[model samples]
Target chain A: AQSVTQLDSQVPVFEEAPVELRCNYSSSVSVYLFWYVQYPNQGLQLLLKYLSGSTLVKGINGFEAEFNKSQTSFHLRKPSVHISDTAEYFCAVSVPTGTASKLTFGTGTRLQVTL
Target chain B: EPEVTQTPSHQVTQMGQEVILRCVPISNHLYFYWYRQILGQKVEFLVSFYNNEISEKSEIFDDQFSVERPDGSNFTLKIRSTKLEDSAMYFCASSEAVRSYEQYFGPGTRLTVT
Candidate 1:
């Protein structure tokens, strides 16, 4: 079984400032990592994912994340943020399987961007 | 681009009432999933379906909860007897069989139990 832990429950950043939302996981085997964003009451939108190869993954809205296997972390970062970027971000992980894979999600980090 | 779609964006029912949420997955996708999120909580997986049957399910998907692909194009989740704790936003998702990790999610159905 896999589990995700997002250390920060909330993060407040000023406009155009850089921010990082930390995420850590525990798994005995290899796993896939992902980041999803939800705005208001809308559905979850995939921001980025790391399946294999590169540890650094880029996503929409200038967001990116680095998968650090040694530390069991996949932290999401953005050089600059906007008011529109304010939303809830979720970090998830799934073990490889032949059939459908199930995800373990973190508690989520609410990014509140202010002027 | 293909996307998952769900019906009855919101529904309200009394306890012990039955409720069914519907979903239409992407045209060529072969995997389907159901997840729910209570207020201020992370999304919880309910079940995953493939080949006309359930492939995996979490403890939350008890006997009262069942999923079916009644038709080639539609998938549904039925709760036999609703409970107050069942009130949440239920999301339907799907992904291509080749890449099951990148699932596309629907807007979700908000189930309100009173």
Candidate 2:
């Protein structure tokens, strides 16, 4: 079975400051990685996804994540953040099972951006 | 941009009562899925539907749970004899294809089994 681990439960940062949300996964086979953000009382919005090719994948809202094969990590990062960036972020891994695919998600990290 | 949509943003139901959740996936998408997120917990997959049948399901999806695409546009999930533990946010998602890996999610229906 595949699983995702988000090391931090919460991360606090000031506006315009850089932020990094850590994520790690364990899977025997190649997997697809993704980051999703959920604002207050809203459904998840896809931030980025890593399917193949480049290790550095850029996503919406100026966010990016690097897929480190050796470390089995796909950490989300932003050079600077805004108050609007405050939300619960989830890291997920999708593994192919026969003809279908399923996503295994992390516990989620709440990003609290302060002024 | 077309996106998945679910009805009944919030539902409060008594335990042991039956509740049905509805979803309208993207018109052209071929795959549909249901996932749930209990308060303060990670999102868990319930089941996946394709070709008018269930392709896969998690252990969390048991006998009491069922899914159907009764029409060309609407998909539904029925929980028989709902339990208190079933309280959570149920999300409906759809993807253009199975391998696309880009499953768009709906706003979700918050089911509160009291």
Candidate 3:
């Protein structure tokens, strides 16, 4: 089984400020990582994913995340945030079983971008 | 871009009553999934469907929970007897393939059991 841990539950930042949401995972086998954003009353939207290749992955909305295999971390970062960026961010790990796969998600970090 | 869609944005039902949440996954997707998020909690996997049968399911998916792909476009999750704990936002997702592919999500249907 695989699990994800989001270090922070809530993070508040002023508009245009940089922010990072920390995530770590535990799995016995290789895994794929992903970050998703959810607005109030909406479903999750993929921010980015780390399947393989470059450790640094860029996503939509100017967000990026770096996969640190040694540290078992995939932290999401945004150089500058806007009021519209206020949303809940989730970190997830996908573990392949046979030909199928299942996703395990973190508790989520609520990003509140203030003016 | 193609996207997954769900019906009955909100549903309120009494405990012990049956509830069915509907979803229409992106056309041509081969794998479908159902997930739920309780208030103030992380999203949890409920079940995964492929080739008209369930391929995987979580421990939370008990005897009361069932899934069906009755039609080419519709995938439904049925809770035989709703419990207060079943009140949550249920999301439907689909992927072209499960291996390292992105899953498109629906807007979700909020199920409220009272």
Candidate 4:
């Protein structure tokens, strides 16, 4: 079985400050990692994904995440944030080598970028 | 840009009532999926449909839950008897193909079971 954990349920940051949202996963097989952002009353939009390439993956909205194999973590970061960036972010994992129907998601972290 | 679209942005139903959530995925997409998020909970997978059949389903997809692609463009999830626990935001999604894991999700249908 595979599972994802977003340790922080909520993280508040001042606008323009750097932010990091941590995520960890437990899986026996290789997995694909992704970060999705959800605005209020909106559907989830893909931020970025890590399949099999450079450990550092860059995404839209100046967000980036590092895939650490040893740590089994995919932590998302941004150098600066805007008030618009305040939204719920989810970390998801899917095993490509196995079943194709599922993407296990973390509980999500609400990022509140304030003035 | 192309995206998945779902109908009935919100629905209110009494317990044991039947509800059918609808979706229209992006054109040229081959795989469709349904997921749900209860208030303050993680999104959970319900089922995946491809080639007009269910490719996979989770434990939450029991005898009461069914999926169908009645027409070419519409994919629907039918809950025969909605329980209070079944109240959640139901999302319909689609991927370009079976190999594409990054799915495009619809705005979602917020089903409130009373």
Best by DockQ: 1
Docking class of 4: medium
**lDDT (10s digit) by residue, model 1, range A1-115:** 8899999999999999999999999999999999999999789899999999999999999999999999999999999999999999999999989679988899999999999
Model 2 pairs in collision: none
Q: Which ten residues in a row have the lowest lDDT in candidate 4 chain A?
A: A94-103
Give per-residue CA lDDT, model 2, range B13-100, as digits (tens): 9999999999999999888899999999999999999899999999999999999999999999999999999999999998877555
Q: What does candidate 4's lDDT look like per residue over A1-115, in tens digits?
A: 8999999999999999999999999999999999999999999999999999899999999999999999999999999999999999999999884334478999999999999
| Candidate 1 runs further than 4 Å off | none
Better of 1 and 3 by TM-score: 1
Alpha-carbon RMSD of each model: 0.7, 1.1, 1.2, 1.1
Question: Per model, how much of the real contact set is kept?
Answer: 0.73, 0.58, 0.52, 0.56
Docking tier of model 2: it is: medium
For each candidate, report its DockQ versus the true two-chain complex: 0.82, 0.67, 0.64, 0.65
- In the range B1-87, model 1's lDDT, one tens digit per residue, is 777899999999999999999999998999999999999899999999999989999999999999999988999999989999999
Q: Give the per-residue lDDT of model 2 (tens digit) for A44-101.
A: 8999999889999999999999999999999999999999999999999898554447
The sequence of per-residue lDDT tens digits that candidate 3 reaches over residues B29-101 is: 8899999999999999998888888988999999999999998999999998899999999999998864425
> Chain A: TM-score in each candidate?
0.98, 0.97, 0.97, 0.97
Lowest-sum lDDT 10-residue window in model 1 chain B = B95-104
Share of reference contacts kept by candidate 4: 0.56
Q: Please, what is the whole-model Cα lDDT of each candidate in the order they appear?
A: 0.95, 0.93, 0.93, 0.94
